[model samples]
Every structure is written in C-alpha cells, then in structure tokens.
Target chain A: MPRFSSNHLETLLTAVDTGSFEAAARALSITPSAVSQRIRAMEALAGQVLLQRAAPIRPTTAGETVLRLARQVRLLDEEASRALDGSGAAVPSLPIAANADSLATWFLDALVEVRREADVVFDLHREDQARTAALLRDGTVLAAVTAERRPVQGCVAVPLGIDRYRAVASPAFVDRHLPGATSGRDVLARLDAVPLVDFDRDDDLQQGFLRRVVGHAPRSPRHFVPSSADFARAVELGLGWGLLPESQALEPLAAGRLVELAPGRVADVVLWWQHWNLRSTLLDAVTAAVRRVAAEHLRPSPV
Target chain B: MPRFSSNHLETLLTAVDTGSFEAAARALSITPSAVSQRIRAMEALAGQVLLQRAAPIRPTTAGETVLRLARQVRLLDEEASRALDGSGAAVPSLPIAANADSLATWFLDALVEVRREADVVFDLHREDQARTAALLRDGTVLAAVTAERRPVQGCVAVPLGIDRYRAVASPAFVDRHLPGATSGRDVLARLDAVPLVDFDRDDDLQQGFLRRVVGHAPRSPRHFVPSSADFARAVELGLGWGLLPESQALEPLAAGRLVELAPGRVADVVLWWQHWNLRSTLLDAVTAAVRRVAAEHLRPSPV
Candidate 1:
C-alpha cells in the first residue's frame, strides 16, 4: 500500500468533503489543479476512484475509508500535542449544562467514572433542567444531560431517562406551613401559597408538582436556591417546601432533615442527553460512561 | 468582559473537563501550579470562584461559561483551517468511512454541501452498514453515518433516520433469472443462489433481503462492484438482484433500468449520524445540515 502523505490525505479529504476541487483548493490556499492532482494521486494510491467527479464531487467507498482515517489522525495529533505540552489537557472535558438535582445525585458520579477511566475531564454547568438545551445551542457545553428531547441545531438527542422527584420539606417547615392541612384544592392551594425553594426562575418542579396535586401550581413566594445541594439545604432549613431528587433527599429524609410534602403524588422530569455533534474521541468515551450510568440510575422516560 | 486568552481558557477548560488541576496540568503539558494559577487568575478576573478546588476540581457556573467558549474557539479554529485549505488537498486526505447506500444517495449530496460551504475535502471508505462501527473503533473514519444506536467506544451517535431499501433487479435479469416464480421463499432462495453483484465482499443487501423474504440468507457467488453508482449499474446491466436505495432506484426503475424484485416488502434501515465526538465548529455545522437532510428524506423509525 502506498503510504499517502498527511498533506495529501488532508487535501483529498477536504476536496471530497468540500465536493469540488476548486472550492477545496480555495480553502487550502492551493490552486484547483493542486487539489485535482492530489486527489488523483490519492486515488491512484488507493487503487480505486475515490471521488465521483460530478458537479459537487462525492467520495467513493474507498474515499470514505481514507476520510475517516484522516479525521482520526487529526484528533490523535491533537491529543498528542496536548500530551506533549503537559500544560494542555489531552482529555477533552465535556462541559455538561445540567440541572442541579441530576448534578447532585447521579450525574457527578457518572462524571467521576469518565474522569478516572477515559483520560477526559468535564466542566459541569448547572442550569434549570428545562433549559439545559439552551446552553447546548449557545455552544456552552459539548453535551448536556437535559430534560429536552427536541434536539438543538447541530446537536443530537439520546434518551438519558427520567429523574423522579417528590415534594419534600423539613419536618419543621411542613409543620409550620401545613398545620393539619385537609384534602381538596383548599389544602393544596395552601401548599402552593407557602414559600418554596426552586432551582432557578425557570424551575418547574415545585409548580409542576402543585399542578398535579392541587389541580394548579402552588402560587407561593419562591426562593431560587440554584445549586442542588444548596436547594436541598434550604428545604432542610425550612426555607420552603420544594421538589428534591429522590436519591439526594433519602439520607436527609431518613434523619428527619426533611419530610415528604406529598406521599404519592410527585413530579417526574424526563431527562435527555443532548450534546454538540462533533466527532470527538474523548467526548464519545465520556458520553458512553454517562449513558451507562444513566441507564442504571434514571427511570425510563414515557416518551 | 476580561479578554481571557484561548490558552488560559483552554487550561481552565481542560481542568474542569479533566476534573483536577493536576490531571489537567498533565494533559496540557503544564504544572498543577500553573493550572491553579490560571484558574485563580480566571476566578479573580471574573470575580467568581470558577473551580471548587476539591478532590476532583469541578468548574463552577462561571467556569463552565469559559469552558464552553474554549470549545467554540477550538472548533472554529479547526473549521477555519479546513476552510482556508479549501479541499485540504495540501495535506493528507481525511478518510470518512460510510455505508454503501449513503454513498449512493443522500450522503454525497451532504458532502457536496460541505464542499461548497466548508471547502474541506474527504477520502471516502465504504464498509458494510453493520460493520462501520468496527472501522470507527479501528480508527477508520473521523465521522460516520452508522446504524448503531449504542455508540462505538470513543464515538457518539447522531440519529440520521433510516435508509429504506427495496430488493431490486433489472427487468431482463428477472425475466431470465426468476422464471415462473410463485412462492416468495423459493423465488428469493433461487434469486440468492444465482450470482449477484454487490458493493463488496461484506455487502449483505442481497443476502439480507433474501433472509427477510425467506427465512434464511442464501449463500451464492457474488461480484463486488464497490462503487455506489457502479453497484446500481451492475444490477441494471442484468447481473443480479440486490437492495438499492429507493432514491437511486426510482430513476432506474422508471426508465426500465431496474425492477423491484420484492415489491411490497421493503427493508428499512435506521441510519444514524455517528462522528468522532470532537468539538469542532465545522463538524457541528456539517452535522446539522446532514441531520436536516436525513430528516427530510428518510423515514422515521416506527419504534
């Protein structure tokens, strides 16, 4: 097999990807003839016609093989540079803009595995679960464990499963707020009217729970705690009753730090994993780890 | 806004992504102290604690914003390089391994779009649809449009919808080959037993269609045509019956170039956009366009 030069491979890949020799030449700062010759050389080396020289040229089967390899070479070269530099991180840190509850509960653990094994890193961006995809579209993160299923532009969505949340509060908070509250909209309205801790302005967990329970959301003065742990702490300190991740609230509930505001009726937020569409090795490895963890932990979404 | 250097942003992004200053420093070819200093500098500049500085150094919200920007900058730079290079012909052609049917149909159009727009070129590698992931795992394609939902290790899957295929043959081929065919199984088995043209040794469209028509795939002598257009032409030249893309077959069949062997029973393959999970702006833009096209053309999965 003729060892195609890196320059040739890059050129051929670009030409085939770009479709026309002229366009490819322009992009590479070479003459169109240079692009043509390079492609010819590559095709000769591959022992097959790599591109169909149509209006916008397309790759032949043989061409696709080389193009894939070219991408790998670039990625590997980048990783190598980072490795050699010692000041540049080789492991691609996937910035995941996720909700606080997911972050505090299972998401962090998923990240831990990726970090330990994949030689990658993460920048976790906490956002309202409903709005995580906004971060994705804004190019804030490479991937997000989000609550949205509709993919952002230039991104793909995978069903990461659902997080079931129950309305919980400290015993003292519940006692002070709901004193022998009876059934029906009257009692539920009372729950809604009380002070509640929310993740942010966009958090629907508390309101969603209320709409389901009392036929309408709790019209309470809300405190946006933002951080999952901090939000939980606010509920524990009797700042207000709020929705909490079942996993995060377990220990605190057991120790009487919180109480189940609603026994049966709670809210379930379906979470999806949305990531930027890139052919990235490190990101891929991390995504796999996250998916594996999500499948194990989160509830299957109805949709 | 403080003009955070891409280098500084890169370092901070690496640390957050890697989960520790030490590991991030190692990846970036720098010392932990330098990583620490950079993070401190960023935090001091932003007037917010960007990193938690705990066991696994986690990025704070502000830190995540910077990290997201870093990814964007890097991706943009790569795309800019591809654009400037035109076809990337001056360098080694980037290999892009894809399935046979995609090469025959929508994939080429997508590549044409990339050519006209991004100005990069491609080296195409054609593999069996079921086996493209292996190529990716083996470091073949930088990006792939694969059938696998579970991503290959170090690769991410973007849903590109399905490629529906129909078992097709030339009218002359069918007339000579399947004389007095009644039962679908016998007809399919006989069809499979006859010599057929395939894209390659790994081409399963013929056998896979046979298996679907009958209960099992019939082993038969096959000629590998390799190229997408040639594969379609081989069937048109009365060589054998095989699965062809509906899009490619439409013209041929209408022109009496080929005939549908299995009329009602069309095999629909769910095609996904799988690429190296790299954070590249150009890749993202290309992926977006591809997905839009796939959605417009391909059938949505019934499940």
Candidate 2:
C-alpha cells in the first residue's frame, strides 16, 4: 500500500475549498506552484486522477474517498488539539441541517443548550426534513434533524419523537364557511370549495391528512405561507385553514382562536436525529442536548 | 350549455378557504346546512363530483377548472371595484416569490417604488430563483423573479436583465492562501487544497466558475453559509473564496476588502419577470416599477 502523506491530504482539501490553486496557496501561505506540486505528488502516489480539472474544481470518485479521509483526519486533529490545549477556546464550528418547522420550534432550544455549554460557532442549513439527510451523506453537515428513519452510511439514527399536527381554522371562518354540523360525507364535499393554507409548494401534510380522513387528496385552492409562525397566523386571520403542529396549535385551540376541523384526527410525523458514528466530544455534546430537548417538547414515538 | 351560478361558485370558494363547512357558513352568515345545500345543488347542476370528500377538502379535476374561473372572476370584480371606487384603498394583497440574492440586492428597491405608487400589501415568498416559477404554476404566486425563460400558462414573461457575479476573496485571505504568482494551470491545480464558501449545497456558482476556468470541478472542503450578505462576509473574513454578485462585490472590491480571483472571468445569470397576463391596473403598475428598476440596476440582456 502507498503511504499517504497527511500534508498532501491537507493540501488537497485546501485546494478544493479555495476553488483554485492560487487561492489554496494563499490560504496555506505557500506559493501556488508548491500547492500544485503537492497535488501532483498525491495523484502519482494514488495512481489515479483525483480531481477533475473543471472550473471551481470538483473531485472525481477517487477524490471523494480522499476528501472524506482528509475530513476525518482533520476532525481527529482538532480533537487532539482541544485535549492538549485544555482551555477549549479553539472550538470547532459545527455545521448542521434542519427542516424549517423544527428550526422555528424546538431546534433553537437545543442550540441554546449546546451554546451555553460549548464554545462553538454553529453553521445551520435550513432544508426540508426529508432532504436533510442528503446533507449528511454529502458531508455538508455533521448532524441533521430528518424524517427519514434509516441511517445514512457511517452514521447512527436515533428516534427523536413525533411532530403531531392538527387541522385548524379561526372560529369566525368556521362559522362563515361551515355553518352547521353535517354528515362526514357533507363535510368532505364542502372541502373542495374551501380555501386551505400550505407551508410551501412541496408541503403535502394537509393533503396527506385529507387523504387519511376522506381517502382522497384535497384539491382546494391554497394560500402558501412558508413560515411556521405565519402559517398559524394566517389560519387565525381566516385567510385559510391549515395543519399546525399540536405544540403550536394547542394554545390557540385552548383560547378558541383556532378550532380543530376534525375533533379526533391528527397527523403525526416521526422525526429522527442522524449523526456521524465517530466518537467526538462535540458531536456527543450536541446529541445529548438535542435528545434532552426532544424528550421535553416532542410527543413520544408510538409503539 | 349549463349556466354556471356565480353565487354557488362563491360559496365553494369560501368553503375551501375556510377549511370547514361550518366556517364557510359562518363566513357567509348562514347555517352550516345551508352551506351544504348550496354545494349539493352546485354538484347536481354540474353533473360531476366537484369536490373530494376529504378533510380540509380538495377540488377534483373538474373543480380545479371552476376554481380557476372563480379566481379570475374575483380578480375582475376587484378591478371593477377599483375603477368604481377611484380611491384604490381596497387594494388586494399581491403575493410574489423571489430568490434570496435578489431580495438582498435591488429587488427591495423595486418593491419600495411599487408601494409608493400603489396601495398594495406584498406577501413576499423567498425561494430559489430556479424554483420560483413552480409557485406560479401551482397558483401560489401572481408574480415571481426567476431564471426560467418560458412563461407559465396564462402568464407573460419579461426579460429583467442579467445579474453578473465575480469570483472574489479578501485580500488578506488571498495573501494568506496564495503567497506567490503562478501559472493559470498551477492556480487550477492548487484549488483542491483551499477552502471554498457555498451559499448552500444546491449552490453551484463557485463550481460553475471553477469549471469554466479549470475545466474540472474542485473537491475542496467547503463552508456552507446560506445567507447572501453573510456569504459575502464569510469570504471577506477569510473563511473561503466565493462568487459574489457584481453589485455586492464592487463596493468591497473598491474598498480593497475583496479581490477577483480570475481577472477577466465573470458569471452572468439572466433574470426574467413572470406574472399573470390578466389586465389589472395594480399588476400593470408593479410590472412597470420592476422593469424600470431592472433597467437602472442590472446589465442589459445579451443579444
């Protein structure tokens, strides 16, 4: 086996990050030619083309393997540095991805706990819960809050809890749109004529709930309000009826500001926390904080 | 031909928006049974299932056609009301979608001009430029700023001009990452070793620029910062080099805070304004304001 040079791997990582040989040189405080020489040496040692010479440069398949290795090495180095230093001022930045609703709700509470205990800077990527695990796969984020139950390769999946949603609208809107109690069939028939609220174009929670209740998707005209807080507010203002997390809807429901459309029906979305399996203090710290918050705020997973 | 009852259509629209039969009845100031009777009558008249009997209710295919007709009728009614009112204080809320970069740049200026001239409440939806047109197709937005050149059905597309970007980094970052002069090939080769800044995982501007310069993609470690202003700031802070809009880069470039990586290389993204072709004074006023601002701020479209 060819002996891999840590210095060469570091150079490769820098080149990809800076996007050009000259930029990499600048980042490492070395001559651009030296940066080039190191990469060429590594390529010769690996006996394969690692990088595709494209603008902004991307790694070939071989390059991806090396990039992952380099990142792992860097993480280990950082852990060692912290351990040796003991002051922990040289804290590493933790990049994580989360869905918008989670970010708007209990995710911030977890972040607060993490920040209070650790001297770290957080870089957050807001994405759909279903797509967040892709960030972890691409190595964009170290951890993610996602709806996918399966763990990504080299990662561990922990069941956080379920996000329960209720269909709700303002009392005035209910009175104005649906005046009297009718059969379930009548309720379903009137759904087509009603206006509904959506989180965004990709959001199908309302439709999914509709399908579960009536065995078909609701084809009502919808007002798409992407923000969680504003979506609940839109329902309150009688703009449209929408599905709100039980946590968000509970208070409004209690105050009679909003009422559940179907008294017994609820949409429960199970959430999972996925993170690298590597044993790192920072990662462990973040995991503990997130799990603790989830226990407090989210509903327990059904058996 | 069956005579469509506008009153029944209005009832349907109210029911869909209100999310419950009772809510629609309340909105119409009638009993819930009355709301149900009107809908049943309309369904009998149409001789088709107009609504799916689902929770929150959805329109069937036939119902979608009627829903569109109802919205058009509503728009026309609003226009007529404005013509008769003359004061134009009863302005309709106009929801539009735009990418984050445009929102952070000259888009707000156009919005300000629109607000100054018209009595309009803007419900702005921030999304990626590439995906804004989907909102228009789903009837979520009346107007959008997008990279798609094709006009949505029932919508007209107007060229808004090009947004040009430059590859830039802090002078200090350049000094630190690249100490000495080197050939372009050498510069390309070293790119793999440097750190790069990304707006998000989907952001490929830097990689696109790299591909254009080096003929391959860079596989460097990257820091994903999703905000536009913060993205530019990260580059200035020596976190990494990235592509910034010429509008954003110019001031920093002039102030010696940022330097272009490839002297003559630039990325130009063409933008277009798309909106419903309906004849409304308010929509016309907004279109005019946006065009005028784009003419002043953005580069002319390439012939």
For residues B1-303, could you state the per-residue lDDT of candidate 1 as single tens digits?
A: 678877887787567556788878877878989988888888788899877888667666666556545655544565666567653322222346667567556665565455344434344555666667765654435667777778886677877777778778877666666877766555665775555666543456666766656666455545444455545655666655677878778888888878776678787788887776776655776688788777777887543
Docking quality class, candidate 1: incorrect
Question: Judged by lDDT against the true structure, how good is candidate 1?
Answer: 0.66
lDDT for residue B185 in candidate 1, whole number 0-100: 55
Number of the predicted model whose TM-score against the real structure is largest? 2
Ten residues in sequence with the least summed lDDT for candidate 2 chain A = A86-95
Q: Distance (Å) between predicted and true CA of A216, model 2?
A: 2.2
Q: Chain B in candidate 1 has what TM-score? A: 0.64
Give the poorly placed runs of model 2, Cα more than 4 Å off: A1-62, A86-90, A179-189, B1-95, B99-125, B128-303
The CA lDDT of each predicted structure is: 0.66, 0.74
Native-to-model Cα distance after best TM-score fit, residue B111 in candidate 1, in Å: 60
What does the lDDT read for residue A212 in candidate 1?
69
lDDT of 1 by residue, A1-303 (tens): 568888997787667546688978876889999888988888888889978899777766666566656654545565566667753444333345766566556765565565444443344555665567655554445678777789987788888887878777777666666788654334465786666666554455676777767674344655544445545655666666777777777788898887776577667778888876776767777689888988888887676
TM-score for all models, in order of appearance: 0.37, 0.55
